[model samples]
Target: MTLWLSSGLIFTFAAIALILYKWWDMQCIGVTPVRTLVFIAILFTSGLDVGLIMFPLTEFGGYGNVSDNPEYGFANPLAIEFGFWAFLIWGFYFLTCFYFAIIEPRVQFFEIPVVKFINNVVIIGTCAFTAYLLLANLPWYLPELSSDDGVVPAFYAIVFLSIALAVYSSSKIKYVRILSVGSSLLFIALIVGMWFRAFVLGQGSPADFFGTASMLGEYFGNLNKF
Candidate 1:
């Protein structure tokens, strides 16, 4: 797992470098500042998520784990790993897409880049895998995504497929587009709420609100609620 996770982060780091290089090259050619920023936003937000702040607090402050139980003495090394990689993945995504466009000039990304064949497979696979997990992990697969209710591999599979769907679906369906936009707004609200709760209402950190979301532990559908 460590190797897998580290390798992915390394790949993203390399891609980010390549992407920035491409951006600089584009600027030399004639891309406008506004266009560059727009591309930057798309790339930056690609890996953004609800846990951006929460997980760090949880892992570093020692609030995470299946039992909220840190290893008692040692800090979680993996938490740092996750934190570092989280920063890279979004840029990594943007970099790859931009790089692909510069080189291929016409091909869509896939494997997560929106290449047509890859897109078809990902959406279908998402629905199928989700159905299978909800079925196999019956009774308790929803709580912590790392639940004991279903096939363990299913949990891993969904982690990524869900991400792929979120990225790919916006271009494919009106409903999904609305949903993606709505969720993006919701996420922004949630982040702002985090600060509000922390400063105004004195609700610990915004991550404290995540505990209230435990009710959705059993919800296995769309993430509009989160």
Candidate 2:
């Protein structure tokens, strides 16, 4: 199988697993489908993106050729994979932020309700700022912060809106609160990975950090050969 296809398979499995986990947990706790579906969607997307990127690199030998012949570790269009993965990472980040801001306090996961509310608000705001750094400008900002030129901005905005709505609608569920915080931490980790990878690649800012972490990169190479 092509590298992109293999990665897609991984993403598919991860998405399914996340959905099932969220549904099962919420069902046991008496949370209805409405509540669980939102969480499932958010997590599934995260897994999907993770699959899209990692599978391509690890399986396909992510790289491209500038000349007629390509060499291993050679730089090519695959560099764009970094940006694509970063975009997905930010998508999850905002989703987590909104969960914390609006959902966590409602769920009563935090002993201090006020603390949960405040933390959620802070996380959401920070996500917004980080997203700007990642999407609007890259090479000028940071390498890992770069994103795919077309879809990144739109996807980020959509995820942000969805999370905001979820937080606003269910501001009083205990389990929601716990999940929100956990999701936020995960999102933060994703961002850190992108940033660190950029630095490793010698990109001064997160802006220049594009590499194969997406199925698209692998496909791009295969297409070139054809």
Q: Which ranges in model 2 have alpha carbons more than 4 Å from their true place?
A: 1-30, 34-39, 45-114, 134-226
lDDT of 1 by residue, 1-226 (tens): 7678677767877767766665565632323223444444443444354345433433444423435653322323333435344544556556656565565444434444457677688868965765554444433435554454445665657656765666677564444535545666776898897678776888475465565454333222321211
Model 2, residue 65: distance off in Å is: 12
Worst 10 residues of 2 by lDDT: 133-142
**TM-scores vs. true structure, each candidate:** 0.44, 0.26
Which candidate achieves the best TM-score against the true structure? 1
lDDT of 2 by residue, 31-120 (tens): 443455556554554345334533444433334443433543333444444444544455455545544545665886665779778878
Q: lDDT of all predictions, in order shown?
A: 0.51, 0.52
**Residues forming the 10-long window of minimal summed lDDT in candidate 1:** 217-226
